[model samples]
Target: MDKDDQPERTVTKPQARVVDPPPDSEATLIRPPPAPKPPASPAPRKDSGNQLPVGTFLGEFEITELIGEGGFGIVYLARDHSLQRRVALKEYMPSALAARTGPLEVSVKAERYAETFDAGLKSFVNEARLLASFDHPSLVKVYRFWEANGTAYMVMPYYEGVTLKQKLKEMGAPPNEAWLLDLLGPLTEALLVIHADQCYHRDIAPDNVMLLKGTGRPLLLDFGAARRVIGDMTQALTVILKPGYAPVEQYAEVPGMKQGPWTDVYALAAVVYYAIVGKTPPPSVGRLMNDNYEPLSQLAQGRYSPKFTAAIDRALIVKPEERTQSIEELRHDLGLDTMAPAPRPAPAPAPARPAPAATAAAAAPSAPAKKGAMVAVAGLVALVLAGGVGYALLGRDAPAPAPGAAAPAPPAPEPASAAVATAPPPAPVAEPAPPPPPPAAIEARFDPLQDFERVAAGQSADFGVEAATAKPQFRIDRDYLSFTVKSTREGHLYVFLHGSDGVLVQVFPNAASRNNKLRAGQTITLPPPQSSWAMKASGPAGTDHFIAIVSAYPRDFGAIGLKVQDGFGMASAEAVAEAARAQGGAAPLFLGKPVCSGDCVDRYGAALFSSQQIP
Candidate 1:
């Protein structure tokens, strides 16, 4: 067979030698095969029912599903149509709005209420404005705000991660310093931004802090509760606070006690404590009153270092005067480099005003006249002097004849000669004006809401009512928690405690439905209500938890009857008295027969026994 016609067998091998071009050649050698293209990124998944589509428009964010509900308002997850991004939208709840609005029927009355509501709404606007004002990497960015369907909402960058609360619950606690530092750095940065704006984040609980999924940067949420340094009278009425996180002053009636950096410091320490110990630090106010709190070091089971313990102790001081003076100071104590105090620029000099040129020019003309007058007088004096000299020479021999004529013989010098002898006065020269007095110094004063340090132990303390209408208020001491009942339309206040085991311990009026009214301005200090279960059949040692006090006005008490279940779950009158005696002593009796008969004894016995054994 011919070679050309025969089937050709070709062996394939990796190509090594492509012809190399001369170094100086302009023509390029064959390019290497195009680098393999990277695999395309996966498309983002579209949210289904979970996507919030309400209160939003196409190309605009609309809040759909509510992610959380609280006493003040509700938070929703939203979608930003324009940017195709998810955001968290917090809005006022209708119920909370109604509570704020009150029940005024007249237009004028309603208008007044509406005005107050609008002012309150301004706080939310202020929060958004504050968040908008900052551009820190740690802060959650606020995009926009608007009202729709009589509802106000704010759009913020959506974060897909659990809150510090959930994180604590899931992780049980941070394991190492690195983990805690990583968490706190962003939180502190966010706080620095807040303080820079001269605003206090009245609420700084773990629930208000969010951690981004991939990035660990903490995003602070719910500025709705934040307030400016100036008197926020409205906040007094709202009294937004978390029992565990709020410092002593937060529960104060006076506006000054409600907020400041120390307040924030206390809260931040509480959050850090929770992160480290898996439980909130004891409230400063509660601790001061009860003196029953265990220190964070003890709570941490010796896990926390002395430095960490001291930092938290300083922050959680009961008195604001004893706490860290500023957030920067707190950060410094935490081993972070302190932020440099903002450098103040030197003041600019006062602008110079030119002297009036016209006046100076006019004065210049007058100057030559005075000089010419002097010159003319000088020439005339020279002539007069020569004549006088001639006359004196002629009269010299005659003047010797008489003693009285001797003086005249000397010949008086001419007035012009006197002028010629005097040198012309030098021209006046203007001297530069003394620099204006240094500008007045700017005075700085302590901001009661921002500058106070938490007071240390052994500091003096005082408390008084801030609101006009008398309601129930409480103060704590080492051995007892005292409550003051303010006289209002309502007659009395009741103090109770709900134990950890669901047993209701009535400390005040032992019997249910007892009507007691505390007079207005009257202060009452009662021993901490005694618990009947304290002495009853012992099971295991359990912690005794009780409500400090619950206040009910005359009308509210009458309107809402006491429930048997509320006070130890419906035992018969005899059984209740017997149990009360067994536990401690019998409490003051009141109206309403017990709900259960002999069964009451069994129920009460079972509950108390179970409570003692549970923990």
Candidate 2:
């Protein structure tokens, strides 16, 4: 704990303003002060002060070790050297409320927690600029974030895999309920992009998630509103709450204690009840004073289903107004579907509000809300309401805060059954929905940013379906969709499609399918995983967006700015992401360079989209 000694770092050399002599004859050429630019880095010393030991570097990454330590941050594995690989990084350091006098400095341990440590460093740089504009693959890609020596870090991508709490401790029990809903259906579409940016991972447990290795996918890691902004900057840090996956309004801040996405929908239905009955489910303050927690449709009744044990017992209702507060109604009672086809209609049950007649023999079903699928992100926004969980102070399994306790009473009114039902968004289909039920199974998953914000809102957003599957629309010029790209590491992708003058063309390995490489986990598939034109297309219909773009090296999308639109056509998607950020963030055809971290050009692509109408 010997931290303090770090002071010398002053290099303020920007004084070049003294120019008088341009009246059409006077001479005054003086430009010699530019040579003092060598100190752009290397100043934040004291590595051992707050710890960055193993080969410490921080600029081109290097640290190579210590990958754990929590009450806020400190990860590390490092390496990077301008991308030769290996990263992880992290480091916000709230260890009992800050220290490190250097190696990128941090201080606050007292000064009365400095306005809650600058509101938990402005909520950890606004959840790292909204999880670096999330582009899901199950999450965790964020390749950059910095500050130098005062705090903040991030970096990411070192993933190798394994933590569904060590794959449920090397499979000693519980997993295959259709492989835990295909790894929680891409973590329920990456928690619908962190509740579509209103935010709230509020710690999900199963040790924050992971899984990756050979593309077993399932990402979501560390984020309980980033330890409640380090439990609001030091009450000696504590509040990492988990007791059977926190929910009695995350154990209290009082005056109507709240948290939404039914508080990470009761810790993601108690991490799917500890991944199918290995343990943990009783403690929402002991199921609000006496529930004994049984009821995965009455104890795993027939291995699971009754709408997946009634969406994990109405998201383990110990009452947050009787539970299941959106993740699109717990991914429609675990059946899943929200951003795609819309006539969006499933949520309307949980308000019996005052609980207890034993809830008249244990009730359920209040999950509604979905009509006309809108999805816009940031501004020009339309839907994503689950954003009201403000005022926080919640904690449990302590380091402090157990000194008064109080909360455990809220659960007295009861009745029977009427809420917990879901399956509604299919009736609004203008096309693709009926042909997917019989022996024709092929769903792959979709939501390329909710079809690029539903074709930047002029509407028509669905995009070729089949990848972990979901469809109820998309069929204008005679539907024909297919996809498969299977890479866990083998680099080089670039696919693009987006037709009907919506523009984006590139399509397949190009030169009519040739060199896009990709091997690792194999699979490939689009019209050339073995060719034959299976991805069908035609006239000026409506939505398309296939896209892809994976990397590890192989860029050049028309030398980075990809103007297209002449015949390659892409007139929208924010005018090809503002012509890939008007190419000055140093070459960006929609974001690149090891998954962009800062001045983020755009991050290339991932897309899925599939809707079409004018038939």
Candidate 3:
């Protein structure tokens, strides 16, 4: 790539300047001119080794025109046909080491670049996955993404907005405290949400920040989690960073150089400083060496609140520890004290009931209470018996038996009280219903490699072969394992963990885990209610495997008919492939094959299937 054709970048590492005290008078305020916007993208590049052709289909998205290009990738304005709407599509085309072989495959230029290329590919996919979890108004939404041809692509909503830097350029001056506070307030809260998820938006700058044209809401765009090896990147040291906005920690590659919320704080503070003064803040590296950059407190006296200005200055501190550590502290300094914190997890479940305690409590009341009631009832019963004997003898008019003499027989003459009543017997007591049973642990689903190998025998070389079968690395034993399987393109993920002892467990779409459908470029993880496979039970010491089969459409696992017993399901993957092939369920890719003109990716169901051992 020619230097003139490449995207315009700012990567100056100017010599350190002498330190000076901040200005106390307005006359000393030396506000710099606004930084220039990034140069317009050149005409769409041709589809060759490392680029996609215009009109090529990436699952649901159709590439329309190249919109932007950077050192690592290209962005395109595309149409999402399924929804019939426009979207911004980003493609990972790291031309430094790899290129596209077809509209669906990538080839590395050299063997040495393989690991670095794979690392960047994984990072791009991971960036999409992480951003998918966020839904803030001040954050761009990543709808979905997928891999095809040789690189990965991310689908995001195409919004109308100018970057903060561009907005400042048009304004010709710093925005007032009213506009800044309203914008940065919600923006700070959004960063809090991102931080809570344990993520750092390492690239937060005026250029990366956008003010939405529709609502005037500020969105922090293009988070830099896809920071990868710089040696492999074409732009030397500054490839992953915006020089003036990036913190000191980002410049060094030291092992203990930790980055966290504090790194984001520095970048965001620099953005605030830029909005106040027209120019970019001095780079953190330059500041650390010479310590000569002016502070915000000195720059804003009567123009902004003292507390707000001070917080910004503190956050701009060169050392991470001296800066405001959290968004809450920053907000507090700005006097938004009553704002609520982010939503937290629900309270934990109640502790289990102790049987002995219940039994003891029941026993404590039972004996004493029963004794008192019994005493009262027994006395009344004795009184009734004594009175009955006396009444019968006195009213009978018959003689009682004398001492030592034979007793006279009692008369059976009491046939008088026909109206005498008896109480109905107590209604039979009902027993309480038993509690419902606990949820059944998911049954295992397994597709053996032998079966898959047998099935792939009929498939073309692109479908892979025996040498690629069940490449189990024996790393995990006598411990639980978490698994994730990500497809290069959008498709349904049917995952099965085949234990060493023949137990086949379905990780997705099980009774316990039901997310069988995957979005384009979806990365489904393990232990599914939301994620992928997890093996809890340890079995015999042998090779266990992960069998993943993704198709362009969802398949009915019921139709394939696998033997299911003890909550586990097992079928040969070969049977599945044979079934699919016999049914013409998968598309055939040819080296010199005649290609369809229409959207073939969606029209014909193509599958890229593979299996590997669980780590």
Candidate 4:
């Protein structure tokens, strides 16, 4: 397609307004008339009656019907002549308003227009570059990209199955547990690869995940909103978040809150919740910021396991800090935590010392024995020296040889006597033992989600009741918890958590809500704190469900303190007893009263309470 031959775009004008000049005399300053309207650039010539459609052919692609349109451009189904395959081609739309607006509007629009174009082009190029770097079965493949007539388009493997959203609508809200389990692993794996590449798919929803016609795996699509993990800065374009599925941060205008793995985690959990439950999970940080929602386990009627609900909970925490911090953490919440940790390099061994070589001189034979006459003379001299030293040292000890002089050598031993003495005492012999091998260190591995399941099952066994159906499961860890539950009866599931006090802590609604249904196979992570609510069918009218109750004792010490005042004629103990009775002593108390003395009594009513003591 030639640039000049493309059709001219239509531009809509803003509503016109009449403004009155200020009454001040200076307002009278005249302004020059606007320049005569330039002849309308003849609308770019349209195709002749017999010409092919606008998106027909470019290079070897045979463009088919338009499949979708968006703010920046349109997408078309096309055939790749070279490969004989179908593909999706996204083309950018040129701005026509830029030429008609006033100077300021023109400038702003021009900048935005340029930005949109650049961002789209950059995203197309980056997505291709990133996706081309890996070949995960769950990720859509980008084959090629190019520009024609000043519009850029990327060719991606066309998917035939309905989007998760469409499937959800068809199935109704809250699809079955079997559906959730099947899709969780593949989606998680896809996310792991994406994050590993340092890219974030800002837009993650059921609509972007397509269930391929004949494959079990779901293909993640639309990298147009994906952004590189560089700094805190968000992509130049407005962050595009699907309202119910997007985390609160995505809705913030400030760039600092825009991009992070938590955003994707939230979206992922939403999809899961929608699959298991039939409705979107309640907002954890938005309107339901206050802790006042039912637990996911109770809500789902124990249809899914608690561990599953906990996984989704952690993924959707309102505070990113409270949510799953990394992809590995999210994976762990799902049953897929068994993945081997990255291999660590072994440590280098220490160098060994070389042994010294034996010397030739030391190993040589001893010299021959000296003459017998010399030995006899030396013995006589030694005898004379010993006798003289003994006589001189009679008063104390024998005198020693002169300090600097050498001592005389002894005579050679007799052969027979010497041999007998030498052989008489043999030194004791000792045996040596072999060295022991090095001790080994044991490595630790654990999956809390799995552990919870075992524990929950064991507890249920004690009661002689097997889990009839897997309810949403949840597992709480130090920083986060995750769980899953049904959001709607039509299979629009959501996994969300409430604080122990019943406050909604987080929610992850399924991305697909069009028909409020979900496909049979879908999975999602529940938000954290091991707290969540799962929606369940009441079974037409009446069905018994499990409910966890925690009761605390009320403390009356403060009331007793207040009764100790001098004004109370009765004893402090009696007054406290009466007050306790007045306050419904046996009932569960959520608050308590403080000590009331002279001043306190005057300021507050006698029966006024201080802090509500938890019972």
Candidate 5:
């Protein structure tokens, strides 16, 4: 297909008046209006419609070759003369509205498109400016942008990598959950960041995700903001949205049906669906009608976890309101606590009227609303009641009778084993007891290590730990704790101490010894004699859990946005989770801890040891 005749879209007009390009240090050299081509000149390639020739100069950039073309613009590999580096230069040339009339000049294809083309150009530059403000590894960074030759261009890093689409095609099979989750870690973090600034990708297909060479770190490309602007103006929905990947909201805007983070969530889920099922889900709009979309839970059964599949299903919900509303919600549902510790959990959806069996089941301890320690407490209460224990032994005052209501008589005590068998069937008039309050309503220690352990369960490496203290049970401010960690595979090692004092700190990979690389079968000791730091037992007088992990890949705590305390990176499970959630998009700090795609095995190991802290 010829690039010139390809489908294209236009940008939406900004509410504010369009402004001229800001002054740039590098002056543009304009060429005169185009003249008739010489009869002897060779014809241009069909796909090379109005693109600049190789070696064509635009400001400080020298075009080397055309890299890609879309409805809204053209991308070129260029030499940044000023920086002495290679760059991916993008030109705001909407093919449907504008053309390169002169060697370096872009003009509207027809007089009627003049205003539409100009509006799109402004939006393109603005979008570039917005992208430049973001500093995330997953997002493509725009170094500079300017207007020249009646058009605008933005310079970005010439990243070396293939698209997720291309990579998947070569692999010839769906990626595994860990690999998908690993990919999602950074991508979601990036999306959350942009979405925080009220920017939406709107276009998050596999092709838009570039996996960097060697590292496989993802770089988001071709955001829809500028493309959307032109797309809306041209009323070219088909050209703007990639089918199957796009949600129903993108097909047509309706009351209460609009684009937001969930829109991107749906697209991302669709991408995952493509990776796992070997095809995108049925188009979201079609699902809204006949609703033939099969849940990932059914198709990907045994291949992926229920939590992972359910989250994707929720995000792909046809109605925006019913769908996973934000990436934070999706992350939590997917069990990637990589986001900040305490984002206000998404409100539970209004429950449907349940049948008698479901109502009884809902009141059972296994209910989803009861989490962590709360469930354990509920189980204990049920056991005590079944044992026919005195009310006072239950350790809580019972509520007084309702105002103006008669006090009910106490029921006859029943034996522990016969409690369920002897109880009368629930009456039709009786209401199901309300579920216990969620954990957040009460004082609960937020253990971040639990989240860390959950992620680490997916890793497969042989790790062993041995901890020795200067004293029997480390006395606060008196004794120091030293631990030895050994792994069967050579990899980066990370050690964290979750002190009973309610603080978490990275012990290894600290300022004293930043290099955490450990050789296979090598036994490494923390707080080596050569280091400037020591792991002195701290107080609060409780157990201190020391976690040691040797990962195939080095972890980057920058995504956690933790600050150095003394010489080591200090963080709380609460603080890190909150930061991860806020980061919205960040590369995984420990890729080895998560599940990998295909037959890919992330070789990593972890061991945890506990010691008492005394005053």
Candidate 6:
């Protein structure tokens, strides 16, 4: 095959100090710009590599035009037939790593890019999930997204406007301070919302901001979470940072230099600095190497008020530690503090339980409690006896119980008052009770890891764990492991993965994402899309087990000698096992039964799942 015939290979690095051209249409809708007049005799159009052509249909969406294409995806103006509205549909293409095999099917360019491709794909879905979770006006909203045709697509409202970069060019001058403040207000509020949820945009540049046509409402665009993951996997460092806009910590993930709210503060301030001075403050990395960055206060003197300029400079500080740490602080410095909304309050702690005596006495008379307790005791006793019986059965083929097996008795049935009150004549002959309903399956248990089962000893209706994949099986080194964990009540969640290699790592509630406190009914996705790490399938191919434990209060893993590393707690198997054996106590109880709260050994709930990583 001729070289030109082969799938076009494309890999474009992010440009430093380069202004991205405006898209054919803005990312979202403010009454889309008037469509260009079609030519009288249009020429036939050829496929633009992997891009879907105009008039292509994806489910209910019919592609009307290709509005934009990026290193990672293609943005199209489409008609959502079902919704009867124009929408901006984004398809995860990743030009460098994938190619169009069929009209719609996207396949990896080569085996080399497969892993990176899949990682980016997962991140793309995560990004959609992240966007869907928020409702702030300044943040881009995702109507819906789905995986299809060997890739994925997200539907967003079709928007029409000029990018900030385009707006600056059209005006041929820097925007005024008043205008900048109007833009900053909403954006900062949006930033605060995401920051509160532990997500950072990481990519904030002029072209990524859209100014709606008439209202001039600034809408943030093109979240870089998925792009960052692609960069990390491909070592395409440029894709991870826009030189002049990205802060020093973003240049490299150094120890003691963490990216957080301060990171976004710097980028937003840099945008302001650019708008005022017509230049971004020196690239953060370059500034670090040689301190040549001029403060916006000095650079924009007489052009903007001292307070406004000062706030921008402070946020642009090279060291995050010395910078304006939050949107609130920056807004305050800019003298727009009144415009900022109050922060989302943390989840309230569960109300204090009643005194133990009062609780027990209050709960004692409930027959449901007695029944629940009887069921719990029966389950535990059944589990132990079943295990022994199973062991005995495994050693020999006979269905008959081993000689000592008969010593185990079925759990005594719940007592009835009428039966107890009346004396019964003994039956002449008692038929052997039918084998005790095969020892009812243990309830609300983590069976894969005996350790987890030991830790949370009783049933809990409040905790749930389910795998993301249809089957808990992943192709070694090809698939990513995902699952959702939810606690019906508010609690701290700690999830640990016991890898096929026998390495135990605490995947959630780690150093980077310490906000493991889950709110009631909140479903948390493991390797959260906004999370700094992911759970990719790797070799040593066998079963990998996960244990998700929820506690009424935070449990200190330090006491068990687990230490955080790379956003995960590296735990010694022996230490974890020992802790499980020693600390595995019955779950808390209410109404004479083991419940998720109230009196008992431990106030916790745990669930488990295991996935097979096949070669």
The window of 10 residues in a row where model 6 has the poorest summed lDDT is 358-367
lDDT of 4 by residue, 1-615 (tens): 001222212110000011111121100111121111222122222532212243344433456567776544466786543223455766544232122132111122455456545554455555655765565667765544433333445556555677888877876556555456556667777788888877877777788887765443477887654232111133432345465576777655355455577778888887776666655666544633764433455667577778877877667666666778777788787777673433222221211111111111100111111111111212211111100000000010112211111110111111110000001111211223333211100001111111111122111100111111122111111111122222111122211111111111101221111111222222223321222222212111111111111001111122211211110101111222223333433221111221233444211000000000010
Model 1 local distance difference test score: 0.37
- RMSD to native for every prediction? 43.6, 27.2, 31.7, 41.6, 28.3, 23.0
| Model 3 lDDT-worst window of ten | 358-367
For candidate 5, the 10 contiguous residues with the lowest summed lDDT are 358-367
Looking at candidate 1, the ten consecutive residues that score lowest on lDDT are: 602-611
- What is the Cα-based TM-score of model 1? 0.42
Residue lDDT tens for model 3, 1-615? 001122111110001011111221101111121111111122324644355566665543457677787757878887543233466888887777776665456678899978787788778877786776685666666655555555676667676667878877887667766566666666787888889988878888888887765445677788754544533353455667777677787877556456778888888888888888876678888887898878788878888788888888888887676777777777777765563433222221211111110000000000000001111222211111100000000011112221110111111111111110011112212224343221110011111322332222222212211111112222333333444444544544455443222223343333223344555544455443322222332222233333455545444343233333212233332222223223322221010011134554421122222221222
Candidate 1 lDDT score at position 358: 10
lDDT of 5 by residue, 121-237 (tens): 778877777876786778877765655567877777677778889988887767677667667877888898999998889899999998875456677888856678777888988
lDDT (C-alpha) at residue 113 in model 1:
47
Which stretch of 10 consecutive residues in model 2 shows the poorest summed lDDT? Answer: 354-363
| Model 6, global lDDT | 0.55
Evaluate all candidate structures by whole-model CA lDDT and list the values in order: 0.37, 0.47, 0.47, 0.36, 0.56, 0.55
Runs in model 6 deviating more than 4 A are 1-46, 339-615
> Tens digits of per-residue lDDT for model 6 on 221-272?
9996668999987777888888889999987788868998999999998888
Task: List runs of model 1 lying over 4 Å from the truth.
Answer: 1-59, 99-115, 226-239, 253-258, 338-615
Error of 6 at 355 (Å): 53
lDDT: the better of candidates 3 and 5: 5
- 4 versus 5: better lDDT goes to: 5
Q: Candidate 5, which segments miss by more than 4 Å at Cα? A: 1-48, 338-615
Model 3 segments beyond 4 Å from truth?
1-50, 230-235, 253-257, 337-615
